[model samples]
Target chain A: MAGTAMTPYAQLVGPVDVYVAPYGTAEPAIDAAVPSTWYKLGPTTGDQTIEHSGDLEVFRDNDHQAPVKVTRPEEDLMVTFTVVDMTYEKYARIINNVGRIATGTSGSANVKRLGFKRGATPTEYALLLRGSADSPYGLYPGQNYIPRCVQSGNPAPARGKATRAELECEFMTLEDDTQSSDDDKMGWGTVQIN
Target chain B: MPMIDPIAAILKLISDNTNVQAIVGDRVAGKHKFAQAGSVNAWKADQSCIVAKDDPGTTPDIDIGDHVGRVELRCYGATPAAARKIYNSLIELIRDLEGRTTANTSNGTALIYSLVMDASPFTTVDPDLSIDMVVGYARYRIHEYALEEYQ
Candidate 1:
């Protein structure tokens, strides 16, 4: 998926329907639903600056051959998964970087086998499937979410694609989860970018 | 698994919305292209002629999945509001795209859109919220974009 604007990215064109499982008070987004919220941002005969915030850290791929980033919309009041801590441009660069790595930086998928085997034939990469996302950053104490980039790569062949299924692994969430965090609120209960 | 027809889906959306249907393809009068590919076509028939290419092998360079590339919807109507309405429909269509299937692989772009929808009246003031009325979507597309790969 090199140049193509995939799903989560595709969803960017319109309003997002976010379901925030609140831990305490109702999310500020609930108030955004009011028509008056748009008026405060700016003037509008038809369309004008309503309200927007840039670069909330949505998701990133740590296991990627290159860094990948995803961000919440620029509009502030929009209810979204995860929180708005980072900038959109920075997160966009990360996602673009993932595409760069996947496509060999030519804006295309690296379909040609570059002969970059991940590990030794006899030995296999270890997979850590977290039981749940109840840990420190997780949404709940025992809840879980699936992440695609949590794979292992070998030291050899710094830049190339490998057999993904061969390096498959899994990890579950830890127990004694505490306060309801962004993880649970965002459906990213178990996913960790690191 | 069933294949996704991105172009078809886009056209279906435009056709479904009467407001959009009234403005698309007729550059001289309609004023809205909605979702046009390549060069802008002068006539409605020419504009609506979307060809879905099935041969990924022939074009090994092109990303085959629906969520892999950018999707644009242009509007050239009497008002920006009309264009904005079409933009809203495109957004709705994208949501439908999510409903059709899940992400195919987590390895690709974390699907997202930078929606620049029309703003509502801005005379009233509210301080509780801070975001602009630009209107946008994110994770829903990302999660659904990756779903096609998981199945």
Candidate 2:
């Protein structure tokens, strides 16, 4: 499931995998091994979203109250997914981008800690989402790539009954000037479905 | 359009294995049949061959096509003992493919999400051809698409 061909019967499925790497990292093949530099950021809640947001501006003249021209002067690409588990690296980067991470034994006990600190900027990263789709022909697999982005969600864990805690992570994609291709400036993805 | 031909994908799985190919070579033919010679289907009585027959799998999802399917493989060898050996080697490969991808089949391909020997292979005599045979069943979760649909 690692080709670009698609058909009318194809249907995209959940965010099966998620990872983050450097801003200029190339999107990997569906079968390729996850590089050591990339950090796995999921077990998601299967409610992931990739959204194109912003408003379209409409221009109107007094002479023609109903006639006008509309243009989308601005837009944004955002990705959101609920991570169910708490991991050291994921929490550190999200909570305090400038936080210090340390690991040692408290006497005979093992311990790891994230020293929280205030920071003006979030760390930039290259995010990748590997997803699968179904088709009549065979398995269709591919990945979503955001060349550059920063975590925009500041969700905290909330406890509940009959429900599990989830960290709603969101990202705002930014233009990667280093990328030469137009489609890859913000984000891009394709599934080998159908 | 298919990623690769599905039948070819299955054939590739068997042909790609050095052990299986050493025994059957390009003899991993299609749909319970032997390979054809210049003009007609032919195989020597002592020659080895692996016959494949696909079944219409159970549909796992209606919206996004996926299948839990079966493929019956018949191993015909020079002797009954040899048939068991071929079956053992082939099953080893198939078992290893439980969570692996099939070579993009000619008609289509699939991620073999999970595979298991639904029916274990055993040495037997083919009633119709009187050939030494070992038959088995593979239950597979075809993640993307399957040749079963195309057939």
Model 2 regions lying over 4 Å from their true place: A1-9, A62-67, A96-99, A105-108, A132-138, A160-163, B1-151
Best prediction by TM-score: 2
- Cα deviation at B126, candidate 1, in Å, is 39
Interface RMSD for candidates 1 onward, in order = 9.9, 8.9
Question: Tens digits of per-residue lDDT for model 2 on A35-72?
Answer: 77777887777577889998988899998987489888
Cα lDDT of model 1 by residue, A1-194, tens digit: 22344322222122222111112222222212322211111111221111223576656466776437665653221111221222322122112211122224345644421223323322211111121221332121221222211122221212246521111111111211332663432223322222
Model 1 lDDT per residue over B76-115, tens place: 2233454344445445644344222222222332222221
Show what share of the native A-B interface contacts model 1 retains: 0.20
RMSD each, Å: 22.7, 10.0
| CA lDDT, every model vs. true structure | 0.27, 0.69
Q: Model 2: which docking level applies?
A: incorrect
Model 1, B107: alpha-carbon shift in Å? 27
Worst 10 residues of 2 chain A by lDDT: A6-15
